[model samples]
Target: MAVAQLVAGQNITIPGDRAYCFSVQIADWQWGVIVSRQNGSLSLLDAIEGASISDDRLLLNLSDIPEDIEKLTVYIAAGVNNTGNRTANSSIAPTAGMSARLSDLVDAKEYASIDISQQLTGQLAVSLIEVYRRNGAWKIRCILQGYREGLSKLLESFGFTRDSYAAAVASISTSASTIATASAVNREQTDTQAPVNQEAGDASITLVWKSGQGSLRSAARYFMGKNFKPVSDLRIGCFYELENGQRGMVYSFDASLEGSFDGVPYIKASRAQNQHFEQLLINARFRHKLNRFLIFASMMDAHDSWGGLNVDVEFQLPGVAAQTLSPTTLMVKPIYAVAMINFNDEQTKMTPLDEYFQDLAEMDRAFAWGLPWQCENNSDNEDQT
Candidate 1:
């Protein structure tokens, strides 16, 4: 066995079957050992575990690597905080040293050892060394390189370009953003459509529908409140009929058109295109101030499927009359609903859409309309209102 202290761009050799080990003291920082092919693309040693951090040291078993691989790189990086911030150990004194120990594991003998130190502040990461086989000899080289910007720049020097890294990071960010956006939209909708007090002189009335046991089309005549949130690629609409036999819908997809009932001007819906659920406002009040209006809500779930859904309608007289109608529970389906009258504050009771429709039909109170059905291409009706 031979011992040598080498710096950047040096070389060494080992028998192809000889087991070799590289150990480095990285102190409190995080380090990783990566395998690289001759073409510069990296391999994570998936076939055999080639690297790990043990007792604050990065250990790599070069003997386990496939013969096709030509190079191995070692690096030190910033640690993460509880908040997931990757700024820990981002700064070090000018004298901070990174040292490595190489050994012939099969012979139990030392081969080479080297220490490369740096002098810098606000430095986030560094690539420490590269070991490669040349002409049947294993050669180890010290990088002693530092990056003020962090691991990203250091990785780039190993052939992982910024654009490629950015693309991977963007993909992960988009997935996370989708989940977070849905949760945020749901919370905002719930807060905005909190149940109002009908007993209060200024209280408003509300009605709710839950798409119970059926498809989306059966719930088409119904609509979701503007306050409801959509996860992604969805549209919500409300259907209404007045005493004067006028019928129209207020929908998120269209601007309130110029239309009226009983010549009193009715059905004003905001016109919008590809709306963000957090910003829409659903209004149900008839312009004519009709004594009674029959209405329901529906959703179009486009791009994705959802499980929990319900709708609410708030009603109030032109002056002081106020009341609420809602279901006790939500529905698994995205369309076709069971309507219920909720008279109590903090109401939690839910009725199935099928049962509600059955009771209304038996009592001759159910209006005649096609059952709302589900459509995979248009499943955005959310009625948490």
Candidate 2:
């Protein structure tokens, strides 16, 4: 059968019963191909560096895809190599002379082809095509949309939060010469570092902090006053900003939104139980996309005070000694901005804020976060005089 040539926005129906192959051929070794599920739970299906292409082409079997995956997207980005170097400038686009084709795996007969060479520009990434299931039939559509901001922007547009984007980039960067399959990428993303175990003896043990591995936990411990009544309103939160200006706040009331990225809670919050301590955790990998992190404490009820709440916050990183911070005594304030962590290409620095605020608006203004505050009344404080 004669191959059908398709243009941008055009589509062709595909057979679902027989196995088919989708292949991408590019001229430059700096470009790489990435396949992801487009319909449900956007995820990376495979990533292959151009330099590692077997026959100057990256191929995918459409038949082996999962049943739940109704749609698949094919994307190309720059600097996908085995060296783990993702240093390509966002303004630099992949070289021209790239084409994609779909063919039957058994007969090796081409069904459809599209040349994307003429659409090249100053984009760091581009969406080439999509294979989707509709009415029990598979179809191919030419996308050819380019992202000038590169892979991160493309990923963000596909529902990737700051944490998930960072994790995906890490996976793409560390991809081996062969294609990194979907299962492998998922496994790497879900793998968590084993917690360190301590023995009862005073044995001298050396702690090793593996670079780019593990999580950072921020915890607050406190005690009740002479009356032995717990500070029920005492809570801890974290406000974070990404390099792309995306921002969010995670606290006791909003803990469910903490792990909105790929179902992995990058920042988690736990309320004080039995008048013990409140805690928050930050996945270290998320630091890759985070510009700043602000850790704060607040009392939901405006009438509540920190007078008898001797609270202390601790910052812990794997293999490193934990650092604790005790804020100045505040008897009337309901909110306190405790610390700020700044991330950059060189290093990360955590600075103590230790400033009391009358409300979250004041804290937002202090940091120029520009967040729209939504204050709610505490029902339990209705009987307060």
TM-score of each: 0.37, 0.40
Please write out the lDDT profile of model 1 over residues 1-385, one tens digit for every residue. Answer: 5687866656556554444456666566766666787676763322233333333333444444457778777777666332223564454532357667776532336777776553234556767777777766666777767777677777667666666555544554575588458545534444476433333222122233344232333233257543343343333333444333333333444433222211222332222243333121222232222322223333344212233434344444333233334444344333334232222233212222432221212212344532232332333444332
- Residue-level lDDT of model 2, residues 35-80, one tens digit each, is 4443446546433210112233334334435566666677777664
CA lDDT for candidate 2: 0.54
Q: How close to the true structure is residue 31 of candidate 1, measured as C-alpha lDDT?
A: 66
What lDDT score is found at residue 2 in candidate 2?
69
lDDT of candidate model 1 versus the reference: 0.44
Candidate 2 clashing pairs, residues 3+ apart or interchain: none
**Residue 70 displacement in candidate 2 (angstroms):** 7.6
TM-score: model 2 vs. ground truth: 0.40
